[model samples]
Target: MKLLFNLLAFTALIFTTAANADISENSLAPQKEANFAQNYLDRFMQRDFDYVMSLIDTEVAGTISPEKLEEMHGYLPSGKLLSTELIGSQVKVINDNWEGSFTFEYHFEDGWALASAYMIRTEGKISIAGFSVYNTPDSQKELNRFSLSNKPLGHYLVLTMAIIFPVFILVTLVTCIRTPVQKRKWLWILFILFSVGAIKLNWTTGAYHIKLFSFQLFGGGAVSASEHAPLILTAGFPLGAIIFWFKRRSLIGQKKKTQKSQTELKESDNSV
Candidate 1:
């Protein structure tokens, strides 16, 4: 009777261990998905096109070669990533197939852009099958207007504002060193350039948009590719202005000091 009881207890223990093991495996599945998704995103942001391509399925991989992938990567900003958020996800298992949806945020052009991607898992690996920009209807229209309007008045206004404000602030900063007023002016110019450039890029690339306004304005037109010249002019003007302005001020101060010293020496000789 003691042997019979021992055998029953050991059987119960084995069942319990098996149940625990299955539960642990189930819990780990979602975590693995999240980690792999995030790692893939990191590689995308870093422009590691080869690494990203390797994670994708062969059919998708064949459509976009490494060179084409690298070309697309070139268009993306090389700015440091600010943060990432796993906004939401859904996983489905049917028959022997697994599919999932993942939504996440990326810091692009100094602002947050949201993207939703659909992934398919086969053989314990995930690959992105599709992606979409998360933007409202109105925002889409506004972005289209910003990009494709190309109306002479709008173009001139944008270009003029982009150039004139930075130059004015730079000049003011140079003339009034050591004054809080100058510092504030320079800071404002920098802020304006940074924000405007970010918005422009986001609108052009469909990276981010004010949904309600954009859709109303744009209808169904696609987002434009970013214009390299405009972006460069917008960002570079303010930066160059700041640097040159400071250098000019320093040179002017040295010249003034030299003149003052020469006048004092001449006055001393006259006194003698």
Candidate 2:
């Protein structure tokens, strides 16, 4: 049992490492798009409208004057650009070219801003298609952080279920290890290790995403999309555990019956 568990752990580690490597390498293509978006945001923050406009496609640039662009920046968060973070990116291929949006977060001492740069590649030249910047005060960001206070009633209910599910799964697991089964006992152990559905809850928002059919290693967990994001609670139904509990009595009965029959056979042979 120990060897089997160690093997499973090693295999899982290798697969997870490989998947992470692939994701890191696959992001290179989008890095160029991300850089372009960052450049546009820098120019906008510097009030260098001409430089920003130069990045836009010619036809689109003609539609808005630099003065109008400056006016659009009214009430925008103003502070020394302390740091910029690339928070989101998506690209779609068109023929051989790609169009995408790269979103960035600009953090300041008292406020923050989200700037999304939408760009398109055509005839081998990249140009901005559209852009948006939303300025938000730091207090709003604080309200969104992971915290126990001010949460909705649904959040607590979901959290309670998430906690309960994992505990139930673990208790069933321990019971199965101690219980006796007639045959292929190892197979039952393996089955009891998995949960067979997914329920994901956004800890910050009272939202849930559920999949009726899915395989999860653990019954429940918590994670965050990014370092700064609020926690997300994920859980699955302990189908294996439930089944094991239901069949446990039958397994124990079978084992006892097998032992009794063996004793009777020995007694009959001795009499003969």
Q: Report the lDDT tens digits of candidate 2 across residue range 1-272.
A: 56445544654564345323322212544776788778887788888998887888877877778877787677467666678877667789968988988877778766787888889998878889888877866633364576778878878876776667766665676678778888887787778767888888887667789998877664666665443455667677888888998999999999999999999999999999
Expressed as tens digits, the lDDT of each residue in 138-202 for candidate 1 is 22224334444534453444445444544444344334343333224555334322222211223
CA RMSD of all predictions: 26.8, 5.2
Structural similarity to truth (TM-score) of each candidate: 0.36, 0.73
Candidate 2: where are CA atoms >4 Å away? 1-32, 57-71, 90-100, 122-124, 139-144
Kindly report which residue pairs in candidate 2 clash with one another: none
The local lDDT score (0 to 100) that residue 43 gets in candidate 1 is 73
TM-score of candidate 1 to 2 decimals: 0.36
lDDT of 1: 0.48
**Model 2 residue 7 lDDT?**
43
Q: Each prediction's Cα lDDT score?
A: 0.48, 0.73
Top lDDT: which candidate number? 2
Model 2 error, position 208 (Å):
2.1
